[model samples]
Target chain A: MSGFCRLERDRSLATRVDGGGGVMTGALAPIALSLRGVTKRFGAIRALDGVDLEVPRGAVFGLVGPNGAGKTTTFGIACGYVRPDGGTVDLFGEGPFDPSKHRGRVAVLPQDAQLGRDIPLLDQLVYFARLQGLGKQEARSQAGWALELAGVTSRARARSRTLSHGMLKRVAIAQAFIGEAELVLLDEPTSGLDPVQAERIREHIVAQRHDRTVVVSSHNLNEIEAVCDHVAMIDHGRAVLAGTVAAITGKNEEVRITLAEGPVPLDMVKTALAGDSVDWDEASRTLVIRFVSRPGRGAEDVIGQALRTLLGHHARISQVVKGRSLERTYLESS
Target chain B: MIGPTPFRDMLLVAWFELKEMLRTRRALVVIALYLLGGLVASRVFVGVIGRLEDVAADMLQTTRTATPGALTRQVLHSDAYREALVRLFPNRNVADFLLGLPPIVLFFAWSSLAFVPFLIMMTAADTVTQEVQDRGIRFVVIRTGRVEFVLGKYLGQALLMSFVVLLTGFVYLAVAWRGLQGFEFWPTLDGILIFWPRIVVYGFAFVGLAGLCAMNARSAAVARALSFVGLTVSWVLGEMAYRWSDGIFGAAWTAIGFLVPFSHKAALWRPGVAGVLPECAVLVALGLVYLSVGLVMFRRKDL
Candidate 1:
């Protein structure tokens, strides 16, 4: 929703993984982070090959790829951890990163970053808050706020080594949310948590979208599609596709209806659709309608007419879906 | 690129490092061992100096007129000790310097000059590398510059060493009061005062060296190994450079010692404020050089 996909709307989602993944490039919203021609090589193997990406402000952007697709490396470069071998990174349009100018504006939850084992969780967070330029009292208050946000306030006084893996992870996530950060980059925020814990984190992350631009890199595409309105798919160290969830999933171009044991009103439904293509699969008992964009008429109007026609015949409709599944789009893109 | 207030950031990091070290009892353990070792060493000093006086009295045939304490002072100020001191420290009032301080305080200064650098390096070796190895530094460096993190690490180690040095001096002062009769508390305290800052500044140089070693390392164990290796290599090279000074770049070769923190330990023995000022500057400059080199490499390294 926050970024307009630069790719032309069509059926084939196959051509985008070369990190040529494009958004409208500052045309739709203010840019939160932009990486142009960024390339990095570790020894002989290239980690990122001219990867380019753009994250629009206040969008829950997901970076999803297979293992070692340079997701973590990209986060590292954005947060000033890893130095890129080539190209520029523009954070909040504040030029290249200089600690003096860009210190407290960005926060990151690095995948492998572990908090101090012997220090209490709260104290560690307070130290991070202080480094973010808060005074002592404010730092403590902010640290407490972060702990509560992560749902780990009870474990605040517990040492990091004493906590469970999930709790420590929540503490790590807590640190990233402190100090009113404008751009928050989380690399695999729920890498190894249970479904319940993961959903909790997703809910928290979803709540942050109204205020902060959050970029998350995860292996969970369903989780990505669930929480993020925008996504960029990276394959082989380059972003192959980037777009809003609806655009990427083709939500505007088609509608799908799954049927139960009911009347076969295919010709009648076609009459309701009028100009659009409507096909019924007898084996699966489903209706697939393709959108034909006409002057001012949209997919919603077509779906409304089809639904009224089908229901008028006393047909049983099990499920109604807009466009396609994210998994289907991802499989097509990859 | 830097944070808005790098200096304040440095202090924040430094304070946290020290607090963490103390909380974990790493510093406390080291300090306890250092104090225990200094106390044992002080006991040895008392025994050794007392026997040396007896030897001096016997060799000079002064046992008939002088008592034990008088003989020790006489032997300490005698021409033999003076010549030996002068030979050890050239063109200086070595005998007067020896007699001006109580013997226990002198032992602490000399022993600290040789031993504390190692202690400081050991204390500092793990400060950055552990966090770096685990990628925990990413969280901090996101809010602070690499330079500040490194500098703050050094300052934290330096402050910890300062505490250890202070505690050792106080422990030795107590040893003198109880173990050495007629210890002249004022003169002995005065002696500790003179060398306190010297010991602190001397340790600062090594703290910087330790920082240089800790940065760009993969693990804390590796950083620790590098610290000892760096100290040994610097020492060997310093010695070789001094020995080879008669060849080409003789002055430059000798000046190379100024680059290593180990070589400056002797210069602190220089008499008077005027003689010691240059050494302080050199030590401070050496600390900065090592730290700057570490910072340069750390800035470019991928964490």
Candidate 2:
């Protein structure tokens, strides 16, 4: 047992760092997972049609879609749980049909699986550990660590049926990290959780982004914006848009300057910041700027220069705000 | 990296099921009731014999001198006794009654066998429906292949059920052995001492049937109910078929009757009465086919 434990610990250390300990993969590797021309149908209803997406590794990816938009179906196909009627899901450059070969490579927090209600929470965690190929002793050890990470270690011996819904959700999320899979899939991890429990789950998820790839799904746009590095919005079974969160949100950043003392001429401000990239809203007493110099930089620099010009015009700025966040951009695009 | 196989995953699944079932008070309650029922029913049979002897003594003054065993033997030879025994132990021997016990005690095991199918349905329904209801099926499907997930659940639950059925059968067999000593209950009772094969067959049947029900049902309770209803209806239909054929279907209907495991045991008795074995080969073959179809259907299920 000692020798096996030492061996597993050594293996863990080796995987955690490469050579000089710099990330073996970049902070976010390009297109860790891809789904192309995916179509699925159940009898007459087409759940997904010509859907396309790419998720970068070592970053948080969010798949945001409404209840019947085929998001879960796509995720299931990716994990090899649901065979697709058409198209393909490629994970870590490997085809999804054969994803079972990547079993220990990814972990999933299924949407609503409470732990075994009849068994202790720790026992359920240990059961997951065994699924990841760990021996009994190793499984028990890993389950202990996982329970701590989930903040349910205190309830480890308690039967899962006795745990609150929030705790059960956390435990489900905790199982996703059990084997330290390179990629983790979390389906609605905080759906029924209280604010505090949701925050804890969010923090745990964010902390894992540095060490692994995560693909999460939720109906809440704010939660998606808060945790996801890349975002994919699906509506009515099609991928409306998908890219890095910054790339999508950065498309049209606007600097809004509100004057406290005097009403500044909107035309003058527009003229000063003028370029094909700039537009002004006179009704709101604001200057709308877009900096198109860089590929995704049409707005950032334009806003910066426009703010300076506003100060030059004695605009008596009351407030400056960065508008057109990803949420708004998504709403506009979709 | 060592990748896991469907078989290995199934072990983990079965192990969890075994743990969960063991902890569930419902399962414990069912098991306890079954054991309690068996013990009490057997003791009642033993007690009833003593009462019957007293009644016989009052009716016949000479019988007061006769031992309970002799009195019972004489009763068995009477025309009224033959008619009554025929109705009482329809599938058993009159020699069994002559040995001083009712046939219902020998076959009380049939009713208790419902627990196997019940547990199987409960386990299967909970497997996929629970995942869907909990919303975890979405993510779990991502880590493991659907085929592995479904097959793992099927095999795991089946293995656990096999253990349970075998354990219960052992207990029942022990009681039967103790109660049937010196009684010509049925010559085949000796051969039926080992029940592992029946457990395996019934386990697989229950697992497959329950898996199909789970795939069709959106909730755990619905799945279990459907499986139970399906079992009950099939057994009733099989019994009707048996009676309509004057039991002359030559084990064809009996083999079909095996679809409802316990019912098949009853239908198999007619062949035993004539000293010929019912064609269990067809029954086992049908069970395997049901299992195969279940596996295929589960592989394609949305969950």
Candidate 3:
């Protein structure tokens, strides 16, 4: 089996661990959403095949993939837009077939979903709020607050067709945040936005992460890395990597040492740390050391030894940084 | 907090659909067109009635000296009249009584019954297809049940068509009252009040069919085309069946004829409270069937 399949199988065993009571060390939160052996087909193409995923409550999970990776299909299944041909999907412990059971608790920001052209922005927002079970007066009030939160209060009365693409996206974001939904599924939330606007949306998502779970599916790996604490990377209809950003990226295995002066010698570092791989960039005066420790030895032990050796050699070290970047990890995994 | 009940959700969807219709200005345009059509039809009917009255007077002077009631019976029971009634209202003698009504009433009843379906098709053709094409249905479907969404759209279209039919009925009544000053107020008002509700029910049958078409079609243009084509095909087949009702294919043609709305046009002029009940039941059944099929298809369709 592929690595993702093995990970998925292991997750089922982990679910049986039951609140850190067995060999597992930490308490695992109850799953907010789960998919088991889900499969879908369109004509000859298999969109999703035997896919399994689990999202814990109170997590900012990122679903990352390249084009045609079934990210949008998975989102559609969760929101009850696309029906699966086999297996099952559960949201908040309810089957995907019945979203109304979790109404007002789940909201979706579908990528490129256009608002009704003739509907005023405020009216459209209010209508969505009312669909979440708010009364007319409360729906109107909350719509106003949602618009303000999305920073589109100035265009509240504008018809959706009259707004630009960026403005429409903001309106859709406001519509998703209405009723303070417990689980927000945002598919490509910042797919088409300027860097500044994308940053603002990222900050908004991070701010909202303290209370409710947010599942964001995006091709923007950098944005995913910046916002996500937990992530699952799907490729060609199967999840290739699924874990905390730190664990999946293997950020703990490497350390970066920045020297005060230029020309840190690679040979000196290589002789000092025998088994570790070291790369010295003479122009930047930085040494990147990759540690491959044995089981239970840990990267910290190796790093400590290297620190003492560098100090003994009288090397001027300015700063130490840890962990691999997510981009590199994503490229290696996919 | 509790979410909306299925019934409440359906109502909310209907309310939103109605608001969308108004916001898009389609509702106002449809209503104005229906009323204007009714006025123009009533005027043409008045001119036709005047010429027919003069012809009837000349025929009375030339005929044998018979009682007025006998003359009326002769005119209605003639072979030509019977054949015309059979062509319009198959397996029924109700048109005999319909023929005795005022010329203006007959014209209004026939014209409204004949044209209301097209009016409904025009108004409701984009009801579901527009949202699906624009991907706006994603927002509402997540919040409410699919069954409720279909029901709401169907109900909203039915309600709009009902309003249009009712307004046209009043316009016809006003035109008839002013043009035919000798006509009695209570009877003409009663005839209109009785006729328009049945027209509204018939209008709903078309609305339901249009909703089904819209749900399956890929775009607003396709929905309109499908509705138009479906109605035209059904109408042409119904005409053929009626025309060929006396041959070896008589039984099959007659059976197929009843499936078309045009086959029930005579029911619009049926007198008394219970006269249109059977036809109303059939129209309601058609509406239910269309709506049920639409809901089934929409529930399984990908959005």
Best by TM-score: 1
Considering only chain B, report the TM-score of model 3: 0.80
DockQ in order = 0.57, 0.34, 0.45
The weakest ten consecutive residues by lDDT in model 3 chain B span B64-73
Residues A1-334 of candidate 3: C-alpha lDDT, one tens digit per residue: 1000000111112211111112323553478788888888888889888778998888899999889989999998888889899988887665674645567768899877889888888988888877777768877887877677666777789888897787788778767877656689999988777776788788878876657789999988888989998999888888888989877766667787888863455676688788788887677677888876577767677677667877767778888766666787889887
lDDT of 1 at B2: 47
lDDT of 1 by residue, B1-303 (tens): 343478888898899888888876666787788889999998777666667667876797866432224455665668897777768765566546766777777789989888897897677888888889888888889887888888887888888888888888988898777666456788888888889888898888888788788777878889999998888888887787767778888888777866877777777875677878888888887887888988888888888
Alpha-carbon shift of residue B167 in model 3 (angstroms): 2.1
Better of 1 and 3 by DockQ: 1
Model 1 accuracy (lDDT, Cα) = 0.80
List all candidate RMSDs to the true structure: 7.8, 7.2, 8.8
Runs off by more than 4 Å, candidate 2: A1-30, A41-46, A66-68, A81-83, A97-99, A251-259, A263-279, A294-314, A318-323, B1-4, B53-207, B212-215, B236-285
Ranking by DockQ: 1, 3, 2
Query: Model 3 misses residue A218 by how many Å?
Result: 1.3
Interface RMSD for each of the candidates: 6.4, 5.7, 5.9
For model 1, fnat equals 0.94
Best by lDDT: 1
Higher-TM-score candidate of 1 and 2 = 1
Provide the fnat value for model 3, as a fraction from 0 to 1.
0.78
Clashes of 2: 11
Model 3 Cα shift for residue A173 (angstroms): 0.8
